[model samples]
Target: MARMATHMITGAGSGIGAAVARRLHERGDELVLLARDAGRAKELAGAFPGARTLVGDLANPDRLSWAFSHQPLPDRIDSLVHSAGVVDLGPVGELTTRAWRGQLEVNLIAPAELTRLFLPQLRTARGHVVFVNSGAGLNAHAEWSAYAASKHGLKALADSLRAEEHGNGVRVTSVYPGRTASPMQAKVHSQEGKEYDASRWIDPESVATAILASIDLPRDAEVNDLTVRPGH
Candidate 1:
C-alpha cells in the first residue's frame, strides 16, 4: 500500500530544505515548499509534479498569515520542517537593533507562528515537526551573537513544544547541524577563513536522511534531538 502524506517545508529553495523536499517527494509525499524567492520556489516545485510553492518573507507576519489564510489548509500534515534562517556575523557591540530583530524574526518568531497556524492540521495527522537549528544553538561563539541568540531561542521553543505535546501524538525534533555545506555557510566562511573546506562540512543530503529517519520511526518512539557534524 502506498503511504500518503502532506508536508510543508520552509527554506525549501536550497540547502537542507531542498534535499528534504526531494527525499520526501521521492517517497510519494505531497509537498508545499515555501521560500522568499518565487523563482527559486517555482524551480523546485517544477521538479516534483503536483507539489506546490508559496513565496513569502518569513520575517513578515502579515505576508505569512495572508499566504496561509488564502490557501486551503491540508486535512492533515504528516510533517512540518522549519528551515528558514538568517545569519549575521558581527561583534555584539557593533550589531544594531535592526539586525538583532531581523534575526529573531526570521529564525525564531516565524517558525513559532507557522507552527501555531498549522497545529490543527498537525494534530489531525499526529505529525512530526523538525527545526533545522545550528550547533550555535548548543554552543556559543564570538561575532555571532544575534544568530546564536535566535537559534538558542529556537531550541528552547522546540524543547518546550516537545514537552507540552508529549502523548498528544506530536513529535518535535531539533536538529543541531554543525557547519553544513550550504550557501549560508559559504558566506560565513568567506568572512572567516578558507580553511573551512566545503568538502569537509556535513552534507545537506545526509542531514535530510537523518530527518527522514526521525520521521519514519515507529509511532511509539520519537527521536527528540539529533546533532549532525562533519568528521573533523
Candidate 2:
C-alpha cells in the first residue's frame, strides 16, 4: 500500500507515543514504531495492522545504531517524534550520580543520537522533528531536580537543532505538556505522596493533536514551540 505520508515515532509502546501512532494511522500515514521492549512494540503495532515495529534501547548509542542499521529507514519521512524518556525523581540533595546519569542518558543523550541518525532522511523530505518535553523543561519543579535537569537539557537540544536544521528545510518543534495522564504520571504522584488523580491531567490525545498541527503547517510557516497544560 502506497501511503500519502509516513511518520516515525519513538516510545510507541504506550502513552503519548501510542496515541500518536493511532492518530497518525487514522490520518492515513504509514508508521515505523520504535519501542524499548520488542514484545510490547509488536503488540502495539498489531493494533494498527501495517505499522512496522523495531525494538532498540534508545539509551544505548551502539545498540540503537545497530538496530537502525538492520532496519531500513523510509526514503523520506514526514515527521520524527521523540517520545521515549525516563524520569528519575529525587531532591537534589539525595540524588545519586547513577540516578542522574541514567536520566540524562535516556532523556537527553539518546534522543540526540537518534535525531542525528535520522537527519539525512529528514533533510531529504524537509521533515519535522518533534520533541515531547515537559513543563519541567521550562522551569524547575520541587523534588524533580534530576528530571527537570534532563528536560532542560532536552529543550536546549531542540533549540540548537531548530536553528541548525532550519536551513536544511527541517523544522524542529518542542512540545512542553504539563501533567499528562499516564502510567508515568502515576509514578510521579506516588513519589509526591499524593493520590493519583486522572482528571487533573491533560489527555495524551491532546498533545498528539498538537504535534499533528505542527506537522500540518504550510511550508512557509512553522510552529517553533507548543505548550499545553490542563485547565486544572
Candidate 3:
C-alpha cells in the first residue's frame, strides 16, 4: 500500500488554508499546521484532530530556523502549502515601514525560510510546494503597494524555486486567486472604506480545489502556475 501523504500547511485557521486543510483531513492525509504560538497551535490541533501543529511565527521569519530546531519536524513531508499572509493597504508615501515589513516577512520571507528548512524532506519524498499568492502578485493597484510588492516577491520566489527544484523531482506551483470572499477580503474592504460583499468574489473552496488538483497530479506532469478569478 502507498504511504499516506503528509502536508505541512500554514494559515489553516481560516480562509483558503482552512478549506485546504479540511479537504486534506477528510481525505485521510496527514497535516502539519504552522501556528504563530502555542495557543494558536492548540487551537489548530483541536480543529483538526490527529493533525500536528508547529509553533513558528511568520511575522518573525528570522526566528523560524531556531524555532523549528527546538521542535520536532515531520520526517516525511509530501507537500508544503504556504497559504498564510498579511496585507496592509496604503499608498507608497503613506505606508509605514512596519506595514511593509509585516507583509514582506509573512508573505515572502517566511515561506522561503520554511521551504528551505523542509527541502530535504521534500526532495526525498519528491513532494510538491504550493504557494497561495494573490492576483496582486501579478498586478499592483493604487493603495496596494506594500501588499502587492510582497506578493510580487512571492511570485518571484515561486518561479525561482520551480526552476531550481525541478532536477530534484520536487514541484513548485503558485496559485494566483483574485479577491476571494474571506476574512482577508472583509478586512481589505474595511481598509478601503467600502461596504463588504462576500457574494461577488471567488469561494475559498474553489481555490482549494485548484490547489488539490495540482498536488494530486501525476508525477509525469506538473502544474507550474494556476490563476483563479471570480466568475462574476
What is the number of backbone collisions in each predicted candidate, taken in the order shown?
Answer: 0, 0, 0
Worst 10 residues of 1 by lDDT: 189-198
Query: How does each model score on lDDT?
Result: 0.87, 0.87, 0.96
* Pairs of residues clashing in candidate 1: none
Alpha-carbon shift of residue 220 in model 2 (angstroms): 1.0
User: Tens digits of per-residue lDDT for model 3 on 154-175?
Assistant: 9999999999999999999999
Which candidate model has the greater lDDT, 2 or 3?
3
Q: What is the C-alpha lDDT profile of model 1 across 64-144, one tens digit per residue?
A: 878767665677888999987888888988999999999999999999988988888898899999999999999879998
Better of 2 and 3 by TM-score: 3
Tens-digit lDDT string for candidate 2 (1-232): 6657778898776678878988989877889888777677768678888888777787675578888787766787879999988887888889999989888988889889889888898999899999999999999977888888989999999999999999999999999999998888898888888999888899999988898889898999998889998976
> Residue 15: error of model 1 in Å?
0.9
Candidate 2 Cα outliers beyond 4 Å, as residue runs: 1-3
Q: Which is better, 1 or 3, measured by TM-score?
A: 3
What TM-score do all the candidates reach, one by one?
A: 0.94, 0.95, 0.99
Global lDDT for candidate 2? 0.87
